[model samples]
Target: MSTTIVIFDPANASHAALLPSFADIHIACIGTDHTIATFTPPLNRDRIIQYWEAQAADAVPGRRIIFMALAGDSDGQQQLAGYVVLFRPLTETGPFRGSVEKLLVSPDFRRRGLARKLMDALESEAKARGQTLLTLDTETGSPAELVYPKLGYTQLGIIPNYGVSPVDKRLNPGTFFWKQL
Candidate 1:
């Protein structure tokens, strides 16, 4: 497989367009093949569209939102296999002084290290932008739960019912993860 690691920010025109591709990848990643039924966030078509629209080149956040996409190549084909989104925190003591709102990998592309590549790109981009802290939340059953701590992310407090599983009415607890750059 061909893999390219790069850092992108929504302010860039190309990166902004990639946001929609990232959203599409996320949706395609959550399914039986990925076994993410227990961790899938509650998302609808409208919400997905809103998310992509919010990342437009001119729709800048008060603090910029950095987007990182990992493209995988196979059979002379290139496609976005994973992505991450991070924003600088406005708070004085937020862990890592930044928050990673989203991290996703295509279901067919999981277990291929694409997620790790995306995370690494996010970390590098964050540090380049002078962000020292990085924070993220994942459900108990999330595949990243184990990989994250191993990746040097310290476990923070947990938020009960933080994850609303799309398949169930009940919520799954979410553990927060953080790391210093």
Candidate 2:
């Protein structure tokens, strides 16, 4: 199967159909106690779709959130293999900065380097938009924590008892990271 990364278009019905799977991936992450899922609330399929729809409509060059999906094509069918979200402030002033959120890959797609590709695309887009820094937080000791440093992100230290673990509902530490563009 060939996979391609593209900006998610909420206006497209085909694209919208991908949300349920995305939500499932999200829940799975949470269920696994991943850092990205720390403190994540319960998932609601309809609400998730609505939220993405609103986000897509509000997306702009710098001051908005954008979602990029890694899609797989097999025998003329497309499936969302993974996705990531990048968010930038809407203010007209101050240093340009953005944050990464909700990076997820389907279990079947793991070990295929899709997450790295998504991060690379996000950083490139942030730089193109003149963003000077990118920030993100992942659960301490999570796979993302390991990956961010490899991607040139500097650790900003770990916050103890930062959030409730989605899987166990117990307190867990969170690690913050930043990359300068």
Candidate 3:
């Protein structure tokens, strides 16, 4: 259980090495985790790659705070076990707020508090950025929808038939939640 949480540093060579694993986590979750019904399976890998690469310049202000939990594998290589991101809008004037992106944990790492750990760091990072409110959504009745309330987020409402499952094209509802940092 050797794990260390670190903010993604795009310029860091070690961090760059895990780029594929970072993308792998998402694809794996979408394909296997029934609870993550937001995206259809066979997701465009380019989407994750482009988005993460675009966040390279935001490393300083951390406008897009990308946190990755790296754990030692059997061969002692650090693998991306889980990750989550907080995106802060660049608007010059307005209420400070951030959007929580997908909180993904490798299935092998589930039930180990990695999601909670990733989220705790996200909330703390949000506060440090002077953000008082955070918002996100998950599939209604999904595990994430259940976890948010326990993590201090209040569910605003559910959007019926909010997404189409890529796996089976089944419609899934979405739950919106927020927390005051």
Q: lDDT of all the models against the reference? A: 0.67, 0.74, 0.81
Ranking according to lDDT, highest score first: 3, 2, 1
Q: Which candidate, 2 or 3, has the higher TM-score?
A: 3
Model 1 per-residue lDDT at 37:
30
**Better structure of 1 and 3 per lDDT:** 3
The lDDT of model 1 is 0.67
Best-fitting candidate, measured by lDDT? 3
Q: lDDT of candidate 3?
A: 0.81
Task: Please give the ranking of all candidate structures by TM-score, highest first, separated by commas.
Answer: 3, 2, 1
Better of 1 and 3 by TM-score: 3
Checking candidate 2 for backbone clashes, the offending pairs are 35-139
Task: Evaluate residue 48 in candidate 3 and report its C-alpha lDDT on the 0 to 100 scale.
Answer: 68
> In model 3, which runs have C-alpha deviations exceeding 4 angstroms?
35-39, 44-47, 55-61, 73-76, 93-95
TM-score of each: 0.77, 0.85, 0.88
The ten-residue window of minimal lDDT in model 3 covers 33-42
